[model samples]
Target: MNKISFMLNGEKVSLYVEPNDLLLDVLRDKLGDKSPKYGCGRGDCGTCTVLLNGKSVRSCLILAIEVDGQEIMTLEGLSKNGLTDLQKYFIKHSSFQCGFCAPGMIVTLDEFLKKNPKPDEEEVKEAISGNLCRCTGYVPIIRAVMDYVKNRGG
Candidate 1:
């Protein structure tokens, strides 16, 4: 096992990981982070999305050892102080159906909005393009995000 050190959920963490262990496995199996689920396990599905250094990434595509000294932000970190206004909007609009993709959707938008708070509808759709939701359609999700952008901040 390889010893790796990184920040998780706003806290510093160090743990052992196999050489080929995926970040999703390390996060879920070892660190007890459940937001990044095991979807396609090939990075095609955004259900395992996480924020690495403020950028959204597929945790399943990352090696645990590669995160040494890096900062990893999951939904746990995002909700440390309770849900944000955008999260409320998501619930208000019922952006999730099975909720499998909700974590990634929220993580993606959290990062995207930080960069482009005033994104247009098309831009909003494009922002979450990588995250696919098999349950709820995109219209409600887009509306929720757009509402958050227009009223919350952007």
Candidate 2:
């Protein structure tokens, strides 16, 4: 096992991992952070998405050791201080149905909104294009994001 250290949800963390271990497995299994779920083992499903250095990335496609010194943020980190306004908006709009994809959707859009504070409906759709939500039809999610942006003075 190779030793690695990195920041997770603003906390410093260190662990031993096999070189081939995927980041999603390390986070959910080793680190005990279950927000990054396993939808598809392949990178096609964004359910394993996480923020690496403030950018959205497919955790399943990344090796655990690749993030040794980088910063990683999961849904847990995003809402460490309680529900954020974006989460509230999601609730207000009932953005999710089965909720399997909620974590990835939220994490991806959280970073999207930070970079593009003001986004149109098309932009919101594009931002989440990589995330596949079989339920909710993407309409409620778009509405939630747009409403959140408006409420935040975006």
Candidate 3:
């Protein structure tokens, strides 16, 4: 086991993890942060998406040791009091169904909007292209993002 230190959900954390353990496994199994789901083990699925230093990445493809000293943000980190504006927007727009892909989608969208606050339809689709959602058919999801951008004056 190797000791790794990182910031998780705005808190400093240190844990012992195996060299081969994926970051997603360490976060969910060891740290008890279960928002990042286990989807395709490969990087193709963004169900395990998390933010590392303000950028979104697939946690399943990253080893726990590789994240040492980094600032990691999971879905749990997005909300302070209650649902974040984006999350509220998602709910207001009925952007999700089944919700398996909601966590990854929300994280990815949050990062994307941070970068491109006023993203157009095409850009919004491109931003979440890496994540796959079998439910909601992408319409309400995209609409939710657009609505949030409009209301935020982005």
Ranking by lDDT: 2, 3, 1
Identify the runs in model 3 with alpha carbons over 4 angstroms from their true place.
none
Candidate 2 ranges beyond 4 A from true positions = none
- Write down the worst ten-residue block by lDDT for model 3: 74-83
**Most accurate candidate by lDDT:** 2
Error of 3 at 46 (Å): 0.6
TM-score of 3: 0.98
How many pairs of residues collide in each model?
1, 0, 0
**What is each predicted model's overall lDDT from 0 to 1?**
0.91, 0.94, 0.93
Model 2, residue 85: C-alpha shift (Å):
0.8
Worst lDDT 10-window in candidate 1: 145-154
Best-to-worst order by TM-score is 2, 3, 1
lDDT of 1 by residue, 1-154 (tens): 9888999988999998889999999999999999999999888879999999999999999999999999999999999999978889999998888889989999999999999989999989899999989888888899999888878757
Global CA lDDT computed for model 2: 0.94
